[model samples]
Target: MEASKVIHAIYTDDDVLMSAVKTVKAEKYHIEDVFTPFPVHGLDKAMGLAPTRLAITAFLYGAVGLAVATVMMNYIMIQDWPQDIGGKPSFSFLENMPAFVPIMFELTVFFSAHLMVITFYMRSKIWPFKKAENPDPRTTDDHFLMEIAVHNNEESLTNLLKDTGAVEINIVNKDEDAH
Candidate 1:
């Protein structure tokens, strides 16, 4: 409730870990999280993680950027800063829009890129000026870990994990030193 509550069981082999994940999922045991050094094929299906919608978000953000750029450019160059130096009509959207394209494209790319990066950081809880909380360093390198929080009893959970080919298991107290 107050902090991250998890117990990590590390596995050396990806094949063993994937099979264990499939078994736990089949048994309806809720896995808190799984970390792997490299991507494991079909692991997302086994973990029941739905496909991400980042592409949709990117498209929507890009559209918003485009609209904003178009509106701003139309108002500014057509109304406020009309230039008559090129011997062309000052307020013609069709004529001067070719000249306004660089600004529009720059604004679109800027807005979409900034917004998408912000969205990704917020969703993943990774941002500048914030420290990351990675449990096992080996899991970031060459190991895979599966975590489950056992509420009242742990005997059956431990038995199940052991039977599923967990190479090493340990209880991790997340709040012991975290402030």
Candidate 2:
């Protein structure tokens, strides 16, 4: 990979980071990434990132789970072994649906939550034993870090970050950091 210089701006407060993101974006500077201790509302919008489709995927997964539960219940209760419980031998799925509601709901929630987590991990390249991509360890605690590439405008970008309430700014040499 080609070496590139980047500026890392650290912010103590989320609000400061938010405003700094907007200001830097308004100046036509491309922000490569941002790391925060907690998720900042609307940070993706400020960074001009595309809206996530994870919700849609979750819904789809939930639907699949519901369907699986329905089919499984039908096969178990109505088709495979219809038991004469409480003297009611009705082998209809609809008739036994009330008993299946809890299962359906549980499976739906389970699939949505578990599958969404897996999808998020896969999409984010997060896997077992994977190294963290966070540039600054402080960002995992009480700081926010914004990384912007330097395109022969380090001085102007540094000055802008200072004006935008950056607590500290560091110029990172990507090649040196790789080692």
Q: Judging by lDDT against the true structure, name the best candidate.
A: 2
Q: Among these predicted structures, which one has the highest TM-score?
A: 2
Clashing pairs in 2: none
Give lDDT: candidate 1, residue 176.
74
Compared with the true structure, all predictions reach lDDT values of 0.82, 0.94
TM-score of 1: 0.86
Write candidate 1's Cα lDDT for 1-179 as tens digits. Answer: 56555668889999999999989888888888898888898888889999977767877888888889888878877878887765886687777778778877887778778888888889989877887566788888889999887664467777888999898888766777486
- TM-score of structure candidate 2: 0.88
Candidate 2 has its poorest 10 consecutive residues by lDDT at 87-96
Q: Over the stretch 30-58, how does candidate 2's per-residue lDDT look in tens digits?
A: 99999999999999999999999999999
lDDT of 1 at 5: 53
User: Alpha carbon lDDT of residue 176, candidate 2?
Assistant: 82
Model 2 misplaced regions, further than 4 Å? none
